[model samples]
Every structure is written in structure tokens, then in C-alpha cells.
Target: MKRTVDVSFPVGPVHPCWKEPARVKCETRGEYVLRAEVELGYMKKGIERIMKGRPWQEVMFLAERVCGICSVVHNMVFIETMEKISGIAPAERAAYLRVVANELDRIQSHLLANFSYCYTIEHETLGMYLLDLREKVMDLLEKLTGARVNKAYMVPGGVRFDIGEETRHAILGSIPRIREETKRYRGMFSGGPMIGLRSKGVGILSREDAGRCHAVGPTARASGIAVDCRQRHPTYMKLGFSPVVRDEGDNFARVMVRFDEAIQSLSLVQQCLERLPEGPVLAGGICRAGETVHRGEAPRGELSYFVKTDEYGRIAEISIQTPSIMNIEAAAHYMMTGAVSLADVTSIFISADPCIACTER
Candidate 1:
């Protein structure tokens, strides 16, 4: 006779598998998970509250600190929203430069994300390879923006600086290697038998559930939802950007979608470099009293900012909706339920790419 018992398993506020501090409590019977719940609130920075009464200059830098991994999009969206309120439009050249810098940020972010997934699944060699490539992408960002993490490159009227000929040549030179290496690793991820056994058909988040939970970014796209915020952005429209999607809705699909998007992001960088326009990088403008909501696609998904400015152009109220908030809930409710293997529990949660830094903020 065999005996079966249900047990509570917690992976969590501190773990070797994920970089951030958050807990996942799984109810399991034998080797299969019955349900799982995520516990957060460990890393709330109260950044929005701190931003109140601060001028746009201070708020801009504060916004970039919301998430270290996807900081550029935060800076861009906040600045663009301020520009809108002030009736200022960035210079044409500055707009394209913004796109280039943003796409570079996206590439590094996606690579780091995939690297995290690989590491979680115990594929350390592949993870190391991806991390190394990410460093190269970070180097490119440093060359363009003068800072690696919080670039602070975007301004009200335009960008802080223009790219030099040497910088342009270096960016162009680096793309092929990154692209080729990514392609090879993507193939290994897709075709490797052990990887398939661990990833394929595991942690499935169906299209219906994905929509219901309002999943965003690669997590949503992997479930066959083509909901990339970039498609609606004016600059991306000019670049003819399209979202990459897959129907699997599994761990493998989520990771592969990121790989594909990283490759696509590299192509975007190249296009920006070749079609690099010539004009002033900055146009002067001042933040004025107004209210507006702005949305931009972060590496994880759609990030939204709602702002209300006072008469003095200082922040009166601000609210942020980070993609991780939605995705993490979806993972705990939908993706982590059913007969999930205990071994696969963490990988599935990670596939949703929950960023506590963004969520707790």
C-alpha cells in the first residue's frame, strides 16, 4: 500500500533560485502541486509617496530607480508625459535616439531575464553565456547614455547628448556577434532534449487565463496574446516593430519568446543606427501644471504612470502600475495551480518574471 499526504512548501523571502526577496507557498500532494500563493510586501520602497511635492527634475531620476533592470523605459515615459503637459516635443533626432537607447535597454533586460530562467532551471553554462552577452549590451548602453543603469538620457525637449561617430561604429560592430550568439543559444534552448523535458509543456498559462489575468510582455505573448505596447508607440510604428508571439504558454514558450524579442531588439538597434537622423538632440522646455497618464512597454510588460502636477510643476500625486503586479497574480492563481510538479514550481513562477522591485514600489 502506498500513502499520500499533502504538504506545504515555501520558497521564499530568501532563496537561491531568485534574486529578489519574495515567497511562494505551495500546497502539494506528493510530487505535484495542488495550488500556490505568492507572498510579497518585503521590498516596498514607497517611491510614489516620496515623489509627491518633488519637482520634475527630481521625479525623473526617482522614476528611473523604480526598477534597476528596466529603468530606461521609466525615465522615457515620465519625461514624455512631462513634455506632453508642457507642450514640448522632442527634436526628431532626439526621438530616434531615444528609441535606440530604449531598444538597447530592452535587449539587455531580455537577455538578463532569459539568463535568470536558465539559471533557475540549472542550466548554468547557458545562463553564464547569456549573462556575458548581457554585459556586452550593457557596455553599448554605457557608450550611448553615459550611464549603465540609470541613464537619465531623455529630457523634456530631447536627449542629453548625441552619439559620436565612434559610438555609432562600435554599436554597429557589436550587433552581429550578439545576434549570432543569441540565435545559437535559442536553438540550444529549443532543441536540447533535457531542456525540453524540463521546460516544454511545463507551467502552462493558457491564452484565456492570460487574457483574464491581463498578463503582459513575453509572459502574455507566450500565451498567444499579441499585446505589445510598442506596437502603438509612434517611434516603434516608424520602425515597423511587431510583437513576437507563441502559442505554447509554457515555460519553454515564455523563454523562447524573450530570446526572439532580444534578437528582434538587436535588429531595431541596427535600424536606428542606419537611419540615424541628424538634428539637435535637445530642445528647451519647462514642466507645467497638468495631469496625464502615460504607458510604455517595459522589458516585463506594460508599465503605466499617472501623474498630477501642482501649480509649481511639482508632483502632487503619482501612481504606477507595474507589469509584475498582474503577472505575479496570474502565476499564483492560474499558472501555479493544477498538477504542477514540485520541481517545476519555481521555474513557472520565474517564467512569469515577477520583479519584486517593480511590484513592491
Candidate 2:
């Protein structure tokens, strides 16, 4: 007996190609998607609940653990919040280093995301090429911060170490190669037919909707929202950075914006390196503290941290909201582009730079 109607697709909380655990249900009429439903495999880990009893200073790493890609941003958020609460700012030199590290972190994130974008678009060679470039940045991070994945370089008052001339020179050496490779790959991106076919006009989120939805980072910029935290936010003000906003609001636009932001981050790092001031890195800021909240730009979008302290730096309560969490709305919205194929959905997922670890922890 044949059924009059149809319903069923094998998708996953686990699938070979998909990195995160999520189930995708699609109503398909042959290869074309008719409808799609995404169910996150697990509830968010609820790490925010863990922050309540930790000391303000220690909570820095806790927040960083929320996502491997955005760990640096989380570290910054916690520190900035602590600074506000305690009424102590890092020395000028420290702030400069924070900017440098933050920029590098953002670069690493975009590199990884773009490579994954290529993977979903069936460009493994380009994906590997970009991944190779990203490795250099990761190596640079390991050298500077001593841990490749989490980095753990951010501490309460400021960054744990400064990038001195010798280290800076080494990092500077890698940039030219990075630029060359990026140029070559971007050439492929523009000329590749597959990338053109899969991404060009897909998942178009209009400019107004992007702003109305309050998207962040490349998403908002791709949609022409112009809400880059760097332009108006206080922490990034002195670092002197501007976002790479695009008006297309398509998959290609989102992908391109990530690449552009990576370049901008590199330029900002150069500026921060040149303008490095002279002073102690910590400024005796953490040992004495109170409580406060800070919201700043992360590679994904706006990151916020709230800290409460008593007489000692020990925290009474700590709460954080990484961009990826709020980023859910944008994903749901863009998904309306249709039953975005597993491939297209995955590509878009990478572009958003989700940090499950960051979001979870």
C-alpha cells in the first residue's frame, strides 16, 4: 500500500559531516527541501549557573571556556566587567595588548569559519588551504599565550603577557604569507562556479530585517545593519577599528564579510603593536574589586559579562551572554531562505562561528 502523503528524512544529533550535535528534519520533495526543522540535540549546558560561587578573577577562565573560538573575547568580557565593578582599569599598555590579542583571536575564528565554508561548498582544497593559513595564526597564539585552544592569556586586570618586539616581529613575518594565500584563495572564491551556485543568492536576509533582528558581527554587517561594536563601543574605541559591513545579506556576502573582518583585524593589530605604551601589565587592579557589567564586541557579536564581588575579589555572582547564544535568532531567521540543504545550512552555520564549547561552558 502506497501512502498518500510523505514525511521523513534521516538527519541528526550526530552525523559524519556535521560537527555539532543537532537534529535536522526536512520535508523533501525529491532533492529539493520542502520544509526544515532543527532541534538542538542537547539543551545549552547551563554554564551560567556555575558562575555564581566562583571568585571574580577565576570566573574569567570560566567564561572563556564557553567557546574555544571566542575564548579570547570571553576573557575580555569578564575582565572588562571586573574593571567596571572594581573601578580599576588596566594600564594603557595592557589595554593595547588586549586589543592585539583580541584581533588575533578574531582572525583565527574567521579563518576557521571561512575554511569550513569552503568545505560545505565542496572546495576541500581551498578549505585545507585556508585551514593551513589558520594554523599559522593558531601557532602564533600558542607562542604568545601558551595554549592554542583556550589561550587562557586573559587574566583579571589585563592580558597575562605582552607581545614584545621579538615576538611581534615573528607574527609580522607570518602576515605576508597569509596575505598571499588569502589573495589566491579569494581569487578562487570569486571564480569558483560551485561557490557561485550554492551560495550566491541563497539565504538572503534583507537589510531592514537584519537590523530589526539585531544581528551581530558579520551577520548584521552582511545585512547592512551597521551595528559593529567596534565603531561605537568604548573598549574598542581607542584600538581604532571599523567593521566590514556588506549590504547583500546573502550567503556570499556573509562569507566575504568574515574574510574582510579578518583583514581589518590584522591591520588593527599592527596599529596596536606600533602604539604599545610602557607600563606594568596588571596595574594592581584585580585584588581590590566590587561589581559591574561589561558588553563588548566578540568575533561573533556582542558579548556581555556581569560580575559581583564583595570586599575581596571573590565573586558573589557572575553571568555572561556570548553572542552565539543570542545569535540563535539570526540563524532561525536566515533559515527561512528555505529548507536550506544540509550543505547550505552547514555553510551558514560556520559563517556564524558558533562556539558550542563557549556557548556551553
lDDT of 1 by residue, 1-361 (tens): 2334388888888888989999998888888888887778898889999999999989999999999999999999899888877789889889989989999999999898889889999999999999999999999999999998988999889999999989999999999999999999999899889989989888899999999989999999999999988999988999999999999999999999999999999999999899988878998777789999888999899999999998678999999999999899888889888745888888888888889999988
Candidate 2's error at 332, in angstroms? 3.0
Candidate 2 vs. true structure, TM-score: 0.90
TM-score, candidate 1, is 0.97
Per lDDT, the best of the predicted structures is: 1
Single out the weakest 10-residue window by summed lDDT for candidate 1. Answer: 1-10
* The 10-residue segment with the lowest total lDDT in model 2: 1-10
lDDT of 2: 0.72
lDDT of 1 at 77: 88
Q: What is candidate 2's CA lDDT for residue 69?
A: 74
Candidate 2 clash pair list: 55-315, 56-315, 66-357, 66-358, 67-358, 85-291
Score residue 93 of candidate 1 by CA lDDT.
87
